[model samples]
Target chain A: EAGVTQSPTHLIKTRGQQATLRCSPISGHTSVYWYQQALGLGLQFLLWYDEGEERNRGNFPPRFSGRQFPNYSSELNVNALELEDSALYLCASNDLGDYGYTFGSGTRLTVV
Target chain B: AQSVTQPDIHITVSEGASLELRCNYSYGATPYLFWYVQSPGQGLQLLLKYFSGDTLVQGIKGFEAEFKRSQSSFNLRKPSVHWSDAAEYFCAVGARSRGYQKVTFGIGTKLQVIP
Candidate 1:
């Protein structure tokens, strides 16, 4: 079966602009997670969605928000993007209550 | 909350040599431990995990990890290294929150294999 899928492997946006990244979880998965991997900074959790509900989020600001679709697909939105937001954004999926997640290749967002 | 620490930022080992990556975790209770490997421009792949039962767990690609409860550590080990094994390794700790798994990752350790 195909793993978690992400669209537009690379994206470029101007500072203060908005960016939207999409993800399709593996079939039968119910939970979607978003993470930001910045240079020098490790993976930082952005958001978690389960059953189309926002379950939890990390220490990120309100500008970083996302929603999960009915079909378990997810969209991550970064508003008012800044140069520091240039990093690899990854999406992962897993079954509810599962211990591990399957991650996508990620979208590299460059804010100039 | 839970956290993970991979003390080593990078390591180099020759092919055919044994390899070990250190990992430490802090949690109130027993946690779900994991080892993930990511190649350049690729997503993370599960190398192994330890939830319960035997402390020693075997995973794909000749990888294995031992969970030490006393030390609160789960270290990844490979008997023989391969050139393809060169990548960044992340150690994570998972805890149950609101019936879902919440995971935290370490800074990651970059592995370099030499011939």
Candidate 2:
């Protein structure tokens, strides 16, 4: 079985631009989570989506938004990207009410 | 609110030596505890978790953790360290997801293994 999958392993955008990151949860998984890992920093929760609904989000700004598709795939959008937005964005998935999550390799976003 | 703390920022151990990483959590209820490892430039992988039942749980790659309720800690341990074990370790506390609850993570502990 394939684990959570993320696309465009790496991306570069201007500070004022926008970036979209995608994720495909593992088959049978219903919850998708997004986390940001900055250089030399730990993982910070970004958003959580389940059953195509925005379940919860972290302390990020409104500029950081995302949605989950019916099929359990997810898209993370970061608008007005700032230099601090340069970090590795990770996606994880798990079956609703289940245990631990399976994570994707993550997309490294660099804003210049 | 639930939170996790991994006091140690980094640790170094020689191969073939025993290893232990500390984790402490604060929650109103029985918190779901987890240990995850991430290699350099890689994603996080579940090392082990403790929900209920036996306090001791075994994980892949010769990893083990003991959940101490009184101490409010779930520390990760390995009998023998390997070079490949060098990586970043995280301790997280999970709340009642109710479908999706926030899971808080510790700052993380970076492990270094020497030959």
Candidate 3:
């Protein structure tokens, strides 16, 4: 089975621009999550979506937003990106019935 | 809120030597614990998980972790280290929120193996 898949493995954006990263969950998975892995920041939860509904979100600015499609694929959008937004944004899926998440390789966003 | 802490930021072990990575968590109720490994430039892979039942659980690549309720800790261990084992290790605690499970990951412990 193909694990979670992320697009554009790496992305570069200018400061104050908008960036969108995409993720496709494994087959039959209904829940999708977004996380940010930055230098010194570690892995921080960003958002959670299940059944195409935003279930929960982390302690981030309103500029950080995302949504899940009916197919369970997810997109993370950062509006007016700052240099601090430069980080590896990882996407994970919840399907094992437990909380054990299968993560994608992640999209490395570099804000210049 | 649930939080996980990996005290060791980085560790270096010689090949064939034993290894142990410490992790501690704070949660109001019983915690669902997990250990994941991520190679540089790669995504995270599940090593093992413990929701309940056994205190000790075995995972991929000959890795194991023991959960201690009293200590509120879950530490990963390996009898013998391998060079390929060098990677960033993360510990996480899972909790339910809004009918979906939310996981909080540790700062991560980077392992360096000396051949």
Number of the predicted model whose lDDT against the real structure is largest: 1
Ranking by DockQ: 1, 3, 2
Tell how far residue A2 is off in model 3, in angstroms.
1.1
**What's the C-alpha lDDT at position A51 in model 3?**
87
DockQ values, each candidate: 0.88, 0.75, 0.77
Worst 10 residues of 2 chain A by lDDT: A94-103
State the lDDT at A74 in candidate 1: 98
Task: Considering only chain B, report the TM-score of each candidate against the true chain B.
Answer: 0.98, 0.96, 0.98
Q: What lDDT is reached at residue B103 by model 2?
A: 80
Give a tens-digit lDDT track for model 2, residues B25-108: 999999889999999878999999888999999999999999999999999999999999999999999988554556888999
Measured with C-alpha atoms, the lDDT of residue B41 in candidate 3 is: 92
Task: State the lDDT at A10 in candidate 1.
Answer: 99
| Residues B1-115 of candidate 3: C-alpha lDDT, one tens digit per residue | 8999899999999999999999999999999999999999999999999998989999999999999999999999999999999999999999876666878899999999998
Q: Is candidate 1 or candidate 3 better by lDDT?
A: 1
lDDT of each: 0.96, 0.92, 0.94
Which candidate achieves the best DockQ against the true structure? Answer: 1
The clash count for each model shown is 0, 0, 0
Any runs in candidate 1 off by more than 4 Å, and if so which?
A: none
